[model samples]
Target chain A: MDKRMSIDEVVERIPNGATVAIGGSSISRKPMALVRALARSDRRDLTVIVDVGGPDVDLLLGTGRVAEVIYAFVGFEVLGLAPHFRRARQSQAIRFQEWTEYTVMAGLDAKIKRIPFMPTHATLGTDVLRVNPSFREINDPFGEETLVAVPALKPDVALIHVNYADIQGNGVILGDGHVDVLCAKAAKETFMSCERILSSEELQRFGRDVQILRVYSRGVVEIPWGAHPTGCAPDYRTDLRHLQDYLKAASSEEGWRQYESEFVDVDHPQYLTNHGGPEELVSRLKV
Target chain B: MPLMSEFSVDEVIITTMARQLKGEVLVSSVTAFGSLAAHLAKRLYAPDLAVLSTPESGMDVTPMPTLTLGQFLTDVQQGIPLTMEDIFDAIFTDHFRIWINPSQIDQYGNTNITCIGDWSRPKVALVGARGIPEDTSHLSETFYYILNHSPRSVVQHVDFRSGAGNGESRQHLGPHGAPTTLVTDLGVFDFRGPQGQMTIKSLHPGVSLEEVQERTGFPIGGGEGDILSTPPPTADDIRLIREADPLEVRKLELMSGPMAAEKFVNIYERERQTLHATYPRVGKLGRG
Candidate 1:
């Protein structure tokens, strides 16, 4: 099995119209490098499944790389409004399948369980579940009585970012699991980007069950401090200041190109060294 | 500034609001402004409740509402049908309500929706009053929280009354038949008088009585009741917030830590440093 490959190779694996699952919560444990790679790959008509609901999604939408999105919410980190998601939706540039937080989790759970669908009581009355008939809906036996049902989400691939993993593909969520673990389990294929590849013995010594790793992960890449400007683990905080820059830059074509050239086009490790260089990089880098 | 002992006063006020909300299905966008109050109600009063967001999924910290500019427009164009009153009805048959954030709230708890200058030619643009119309006029009760207790925010006659709970608009909209509570970082105020002019109710922790007086946009009316403090999270409240949802702890930690402690985490500052340090820019051409 190929444990690592150039970003172009990873992009090649994503079919033109594939539905992909992305893991992370806001910036924590996000595959920012991989996302930038995919964006630069010029992949179009793709559907992205995510849990971040923030600028990660906004960047993709703004670049016109995503044809549709299935998400719960898209606000700024702490303030109100994710302006990019809003403007894109307003223009109808992309289609959407909306869900409440619970139902989205339930849908992923259904996929992991290999079930056809999941039953949920969320959005039973409001117009949200009604908006996306593909995944969001009401099971009406009769009358106004309704039961909300979210369709199972079986993505073509799940792209995840984690703190550490072993040669055998056993991954550990360093601090918080976020949604990456769930997305990995729910997809048909799982690709993880990690900081360090531990020896198999060291991973087993930790003792927490690497259930998703052995069971679901198809490939893993060792990209030290992969989620930079975002959190890694046991080290620094998200470069929220940098993230804000991404949001502003990604809003325009010129800005995005500048972002792409500087960050995305590099070996994963080089990307890190280049962005912050070695020492300041060494200080904050988790791996 | 009220001492720590005064904490119970805020709790009582919050509990008073909670008591009235029992049995109602509640709904609200996730915002720090109303999140604590909403979280309190969700944990204590509305457990079986569900949260909805405009972003379909894959959006925010949790899959909760991630506010975007367009969605803000949607929320404004078509007010989230899940009205505060509707949420109240779910909490209880009679009515349910929430204490929301207002940009510029006034003595009558009348919130400003339009621009500060003339409605047509406003100097500074504020988020137009999105749901205040329904929240103040239709809900059985309305509550307002002003985080920054400043003179500009708590004014005499708001340039434009976005949601009406005060004298003139109250007469125009008639009554939705509910009392209003106005809480500020400085102090607590409540609607009194026939026209719903806000009367000083309580002061918050670390706020001076004189400060509250000086910051008012307009003169406050009624008895200067003993000002009070807000309740710290109860053990049970903390437990549910931390465990019932793991994200709460993580989210709070992130929000409270060093990255967040910046006086201002501006891209400009970051850009200057990133450039000065001579590091490679990841996405585009800029510094931060």
Candidate 2:
């Protein structure tokens, strides 16, 4: 069955205060267009789950749409710390639960397998256990070792951006598939935005690169440059100059307001125009 | 009239870090300096070393002059592109060794990349704990490289324990072990003292023991007689570092504020120029 839908329609289906998993690791392959759409919508008080985040988390925090965040790390690698996230945390603006990278994966794994919890040696003695007390310690059934029980992290929805997809909801990631597939499997519903939409036959040629199966996706939107600011590898790189401008604007409240008005509040087409148009973006950001 | 040192502090630290690795499977995180040290080791002594660049799976990646934000994508093309799960599994079960750059590291080798001050309401919020907790708990060996060595960074106790150390509470936690050595701008150190206290292994040339003691927050181990001068980088080692990182990206670790910013801009411009020269067609396409 054809599962294609518009980005706005996908956003409209999401309820307020839902647990949404944002796919991608730091600075790579994030579903930013979907995130921007969610921010532009009237949705509020979201609990975002991300393994590694960059500007996507910060933008939601800056827009005051997020009430809590579950993440392992949220800083921009190399560029510096994320300003809005830092400010929000420092001021007690939002509640956050920190987990190690492994625990986050383990939690998702448990949910995917339909298990109550997963066992791992991670987060045993670290202060992560102290902060996130929900994680329990259980003795090994067969041995003397103790393991941390990572509970299932079942998201209400998962949003991901991919390099290629079909109307049937099958997707292909040309670069490192950084837990995007896991997030899709772990969430109840998954939506994907693709840089290009191909026929099912054409997508089949990718073989193992086609990690996102059709069964995992509820909807797919063909949105070119969907991972802008972040990157969709083999197609374009991160718009570093734009990210620098974002950092500059995010430094102060007034700057952030101006940025939101110029970029965040606009439609995807307007945002594309404001971000130097398709021609400029392709020329500069293309790998 | 000023005296000049034979080697910069970064070069010596890189060399010292390289000396510790023995051609094993090494994992390196985001720090350019630590990555460069791992690359240098692979090229010089540990030719058999397998370097896995994390958060993205780029195994046995070749060296680059400067690392862009999308470096993993570029490196993954040259080598294998494993998923995040594969990388985490390797670190957990394979007993790979790793080097981390933490915001705060205590004497017992406990490190914190999380928030500072209180965990509930932090005085300063840092990047949340990424992989250090699992890396330290499961890896065969964990090492640290610090660009800035001061009382604030080399603290008495980390505000948050993002990585397990040799603290009393961690005895039965089944951690692989505390970090073996920590290389910094001032010197090299090991947790060999009684109760896993940080002991000075060697001081960089021209640095006095008093300077290290003053910079450290706690009373450091290793007596004056026991401490040795850190061996300076050989000519070959310096050449290898320069060749691997021609734009001197490793130097940014030692600098801060406006100086580092200015240097970074210079390096970025040089990197662009080099890229254009090497790939003229792609460069013109990018510009046009």
Candidate 3:
């Protein structure tokens, strides 16, 4: 079965008000091309889930597409706090559900195991419990210990970017698979965007790096330099200059609109051209 | 003896943090200052220490002295790559120890990186609690490195508890332990005070105990005669720190405002120069 599709098709499958889990941590390996496409699309009321978000979460929120965000941390690492996310949260422009990195994983673990909830001692003594009242405290059935019950967070769609993928939906991540596998397992459907599409035989050469099997994916789209601005590991590094530009533009409403019109509203090829070109991006971003 | 004027306060904090590690498995985030301490400790004190870099999910990473951006990418390429799930599981083990950097810490050592004021509508929304809760709760000995130690940072009470500390609130929270020590610009503190309050362990050279108390929001333990002077970094320690971070990226945490911005630009320029010098053909890709 050829499970390949265009970026537009993947975005079309995700309806408005859908719960979407984005793969990547902070400023590495984020599916930015697909995220940009989603931003260009008229999708609205998205409840986005991420462990450590970077520009992807900020872009969605900046475009007013996201209604809520369920996340552990969302910042630009050393670059400073995410301007759009900070603005949205401070002004009460969007609702947010906060969880620690462990609880976020535990919630996904519950979904993967097909359980109602997973018990953990993560947020017991913290005020994170007060903000998120849905997470209940209960005694272990088998033991006498109190634990926070993290409910299963089942996303309707999971968007992941990888280094390589075959037409059969097998994906390979050259770098750390930061919760991307868990997102694929827990989501109802998973779509992958890859920098390159290889043959089944070529995919096998990656050995253990082929962490995403065909069974876990619904569709795979070939989008070279897909994780640009962020990174695709041994292939390229983050375009910090571009991120600094993004930070400056995202600081204000007018600047954000100007940025969207130039970067987010355009097609992927044009977007590549705007960043110089494929050659420039590959040479510059390539590790 | 390295003179007090020879090293910055950041170097003192880094050496102090490095001294606390005993060749244990150390998990570190992408923060520049904390990661430097971990590297320094591994290099000088704890050669056998396993440094697990999080978010990137690299194990035993001996990273370049560049900031988090350069270091994390280098870590992914050089270190053994593991999945985030693998890292999450490793945190619960007995060998797991981590060093964290939080925005705010209270008298009882509870940390808050979530918000500044109210939870419903925060005055300033900092980054949400990342892994502090889980790391502090599970690890037997967790360490902290606060770059700036003002009343705002060391508060009387945290607005939100991102990491469980040695406070009254943590009594019923299973078998979790409080933070072992907090390495700050002023000095070193531990939770060995009365009722597990943050007590002064050592005052940095030239930093009086009165100054530390005045800067702290709550009353600190270890008054006057009890306070010990933080040992200055030896000449060998200074040489190793400078060798590990030639561009002086550790100084970024110690600076704020326009000073930090100027320093960041300078560091990036130096990094780009080093990159271009090494790979001449890789110069055409616009200023990164």
Share of native C-alpha contacts between chains A and B (below 8 angstroms) recovered by candidate 3:
0.60
Q: How big is the positional error of residue A141 in model 2, measured in Å on the Cα after superposition?
A: 2.3
Of candidates 2 and 1, the better by lDDT? 2
TM-score per candidate, chains pooled: 0.57, 0.94, 0.94
Question: Runs in model 1 with CA error above 4 Å?
Answer: A1-6, A79-83, A135-145, A209-211, A251-253, A266-270, A284-287, B1-262, B266-288
RMSD of each: 12.9, 3.1, 3.4
User: What order do you get sorting by DockQ, best first?
Assistant: 2, 3, 1
Residue ranges of candidate 3 with Cα displaced over 4 Å: B53-56, B69-78, B257-266, B269-288
Q: What is the lDDT of candidate 3?
A: 0.81
| CAPRI tier of model 1 | incorrect
For B57-171, candidate 3 gives per-residue lDDT tens digits of 5667665456435433443345667666666677777456667888999988899999988877889999999988888778778788788789999999998998888767676
TM-score of 2: 0.94
| Residue-by-residue lDDT tens digits, candidate 3, A35-78 | 99999899999999998898999999988899999999999876
Q: Note the clash tally of each candidate.
A: 41, 0, 0
Task: Assess each prediction's global lDDT (C-alpha) against the native.
Answer: 0.56, 0.81, 0.81
CA lDDT of A35 in candidate 3?
97
Give the alpha carbon lDDT tens digit for every residue of B126-192 in model 1: 4333334445545666666665678888888676665665565544344553346776655667787
